[model samples]
Target: MDDKKIEKRIMVPDNLDVQIDDKRITIKGPRGQISKDFSDPRFSKRISIGRSGNEISIVADSNEKKIRSLCGTIAAHARNMIGGATSGYKYKMKVFYTHFPITISVKDKEVQIRNFVGEKGARTARIIGNAEVNVGKDELEIVGVSIEDVGQTAANIEQACKITKRDRRVFQDGVYLTGKYLETGERIKG
Candidate 1:
């Protein structure tokens, strides 16, 4: 069997402070602060943020070659966290009504989906964690620090309108993802 290896890298934002405590990390910026405790033991990540200089470094020590890439992956995730925390992330979706116009609202932190597919009533989208969903002027915006959160929120909203046992070729009427973003509010140029 071949032994795994551990690779390391460092990432820093153009403007932000990154701090690390044990396995936990905290990223601070003008927008807000993002912190969490991660215990995976697969890699070691540390953050240092101050006037002197802000930096996040990752290094992995293992006996297997794969461990190197695994560490790099973990570090990449950490880098993504830094980027997400500093600038934040958002996902945009648009409601498409081919058959019947659907009305969706975000209230009580839960999304109230109504009048989908000309059904009798509507459906509901379950809000997960701190993910924020806002529906304004035909635009659905999903915002959060964690990419996973924003992505999952979009998923929840999309899944809530999913139609099972229906011919997708014929019944193509529902809310669809019209846009996405990387925390800059600028639409994802696709």
Candidate 2:
């Protein structure tokens, strides 16, 4: 039987500090600190993560596609953590409505959507992690040290006002993502 294992390695930058404990990883940098728990049981036993002399490594028991994919995912997550800790992430959203004006507000770690498509009550979306949500008259901004948390919070806000049981052709009232800004000064518009 030929036994071969797949391994992925990440070089820790000089400005970033990493800590790994069991299934959790924490990264600290100039921007802030981001900690995540990779406790999923699917690959916990088959995969291992460790660090040595400014380098982090992920090793899988086998070279199977699934194992390889998981290793890649974990590596990507680590990269994101490092990037977020260094530069941070920003997501911009715009409120659009044809009939009734929409209002957005953030309070108590929750985003509240009022008068969405003329709804009687308000719809709320929970803010994940330590993401900072800024609600403006027509613009919404989410900023966080973790890309996943900021992006997920933006998605949750965008999905909160999903139009349903209405004519899709006529009623186009909803929140939409307008742009994304990364630490590298790259801008993405949609």
Q: Best TM-score goes to which candidate?
A: 2
> Could you tell me the TM-score of candidate 1?
0.80
RMSD of 2: 2.2
RMSD to the hidden true structure, all candidates: 3.9, 2.2
Model 2 lDDT per residue over 1-190, tens place: 2258988898889999899998789999998999988777888998899998998899888888888898899898998898788888888888989878988888899999999888899999989999999888889889889888988998898789888888978987888888888756677344
TM-score, every prediction? 0.80, 0.90
lDDT of 1 by residue, 10-78 (tens): 656667777767666677776566776655644443222122244555544354555555656657677
* Cα lDDT listed for each candidate: 0.69, 0.87
Q: Which 10-residue span in candidate 1 carries the lowest summed lDDT?
A: 43-52
Give the CA lDDT, 0 to 100, for residue 112 in model 2: 95
